[model samples]
Target: MPDGGPVIVGISRSTEKIREIVRKVADVDLNVLISGESGVGKELVARSLHYFSSRKKRPFIKVNCAALPGELIETELFGYEKGAFTGADKQKMGKFEAAADGSIFLDEIGEIPMSMQAKLLQVLQDQKFPRIGGHKEIDARARVIAATNRNLEAEILSGNFREDLYFRINTISIVVPPLRERPEDVEPLVYYFLDRLSKEHRLPKPDISPRLMKLLKGYHWPGNVRELENYLKRLLVLGESKELEAELEAAGDGWNSETDTASSQEAVIEEAAKEVLPNKNSREKQFPSLKEVRDKAVYRVERALIKQVLEETNWNRREAAKILKISYRALLYKLKDMNLTPH
Candidate 1:
């Protein structure tokens, strides 16, 4: 198999086919569209295309269309001259300019606003676009590779996405199968994550018994490889084989076992919460307001979840966004808001 790229890992036939397509498409400059469910590793395939292409030595830029605010989308893609906007104090190079003579991966392409679609199409059609506040046109020498989890056909029918832009970027399309559809790759992926994550965290790798591996393969991973990777990370963090054993038993016997484990999990959570939040008795006579308490709790959980997901994906925000089922832009905002920097 072509192996897609260093980041792509799987032994399934479906995976092999995707890798082959990526290898073939990488050699060409045609705009390529990658279609897959969120967390199915569309960006990895995009990276693979860039990694194997002739432009490998050049910059490989990525822009998440869904993450860019509607008002800023144009300026973000095309450079803006000084005084173009309130914050445009100086001329800034956009993603396209930065990606000159290389490849640009536009993720969540379906979420691009309709108003910006025509401008994007213009660039694709003419390979030239003017800066936000400049009269001169700048040539876009970068090859475009776009990926989306949405059904563009449906978006076109609903008039949400432009058919012209779709055709422009869809010169070649590659669809990555979801994890459930590629069961044969599950075991290999499990071990891969185990080894990588173990080395990453400087922890001992845990052994997965055949029965546990079977249980893992049988489960429907709605979140795809990302979800599997997160699960492995959780296991490593908890340092408990019994947790997976309990989960597998629950899967086999249904809700009864889960109900039994829920209490123990809840106790652990409560203890952790208490450590983070001061005890009521230990607080001063005046208690904190309800809103303050709620806000603190929310902040703690949100920060923790974001940090955990980031660790699992090795700080790949795009994959973390897919697993969290949020826009890539939103994830960035949260990281900023929560001040949760990757360690």
Candidate 2:
């Protein structure tokens, strides 16, 4: 937050210490292991490291070890010679080769199969590996950065992750705390996304109401920064052209239509809506869409916002519901109603 270094989000002493560690790690070429939850933006840390390192001008390759098939993990990491396999019609450089004199971020490293761990270990140990079905050796001059959400120590104990590989790639470890632990960041992150979306879409600046901020501050974020970004994206899209007055009206109508049948439900929704939404004229057609399209748009916006917040908050339904100013059960219903992605 000073001297144009980087934006460090979070309040705890541990987070501050971790931020310092990350900044120091980013300044070197040493092996870095970024550990965090799925949506905590480990890749962001990896990118930051590459940018901060001397190798910033060189390649910065990111490989999703978790998504790669176990059969091809070796080839993907170490490259393949021409005709090495049925699909190896041409010579293909592995991530390490592509990242020569650069950085390679092996994401979701914990999901790498045990069979391939030794080969990975060898590359880290020897800085070289033979392309698949080739006799000639390929040097791996790239710096290694690995990320994972899993507990590698537990995996090593379980014989799933190689101890040597673990020790090799984790020369420096940086744990990114989840968003729930950094409530202070929620407000700024929401504003950041709002700004980003505004510029990206060439729309006017968007806003998150004070009531919404209060609601956001009280909620737990299981998914972390990634989730928060997604919600802001949806909010920007939903409110880009609509006045602040419009969103409140829409939320009000949404609350009314969903709960009009039961008097008790109406009271609950009304109370929460009033508490969370800014006071505005409900009679105005500020969003420029009628009942049907507006309702659908709200559903889309709500689903996107809720799912992103959940992802940012680490899928904690309770926390997500609180941010949305709804009950946990109501959030579930909305998610189901919108056919939203679970994670």
Candidate 3:
């Protein structure tokens, strides 16, 4: 991570690549499209771009496109004159005008309605737009950095997103990989979150046992770094608990749970513990060595994660590789080693 900017704490190759891309393009005034799963720190990347850019002194406006209704989007971005609508009472500055020479981040860019997409495209192309119910055109000088979780190419093919608009906002694209694909970054992220969250909450950092740390690194984080941070927050508030250990153990057991399900964490963790944890009652049973257990667990989780990513990408190895943050050749080697194929 660079100084005086959003700190993307990671030693993983993927994190370094993101840092490299930010350094190279931070000063370049081009639209950057950052695509990743929700809570994967897309906004952090956007902020880092703005912080390091030439427009660092100017405003950095953020508009959640998904949060705005279709009817109000146009007026929201370009602003409106007094009495432009029924609720209009006074002159208002639009995001573009307010952004000035800074950057305007359009979060969830794919959710913008088709009608509004054309208008946005025009603004990006012409570098100027008019206020609603006003003739005066304002220059759109802000750098545009858009992010989306949706597959915009699919949206375009389905006639929901404008291809021209896609090209306009996607002059440079950066893909932030999910946490499961970058387990190496887990330790640093855990420490970083612990330190920050402790200071924020005025609590001392709790000692994380090596066993628990191993579980955290091995677990497949469904919510990515956001999920990790939340878990750390709970840890900070509640200290280490058996419940938390069980929940993390479930992820290590190869459960691909969705982030939306609250109960899934408990259910799967309980089930996984029953299956994987050694039973104390079996006196005659010879348990596997710790090394064997760890190797097997890693193999199982890695296979499941790779398969899931590949399936999500519809067997597009290149896309899967990008999402996995591994080189194309490395992904090929892994596929071969793991004996994985398109389902």
The digit string of per-residue lDDT tens for model 1 on 211-319 reads 8888888776768888889989988887767867677566656644565457654654575466556667864755667787678777776676778779879999999
Give the better candidate number (1 or 2) by TM-score: 1
CA RMSD (A), model 2: 17.9
Where model 2 places Cα greater than 4 Å from the true spot, the runs are 1-15, 240-343
Residue 198, model 3, lDDT: 91
Model 2: per-residue Cα lDDT over 4-82, one tens digit each: 4345555566566766776687767689898988787688778778777788789999999878889788888878889
CA shift of 322, model 2, Å = 31
In model 1, which regions exceed 4 Å deviation?
1-5, 248-343
Give the worst 10-residue stretch by lDDT in candidate 1.
252-261
Candidate 1 matches the true fold with a TM-score of 0.71
- lDDT scores in order: 0.85, 0.75, 0.88
Q: After superposition, how far is residue 100 of candidate 3 from its true place, in Å?
A: 0.6
Q: Each candidate's TM vs. the true structure?
A: 0.71, 0.66, 0.74
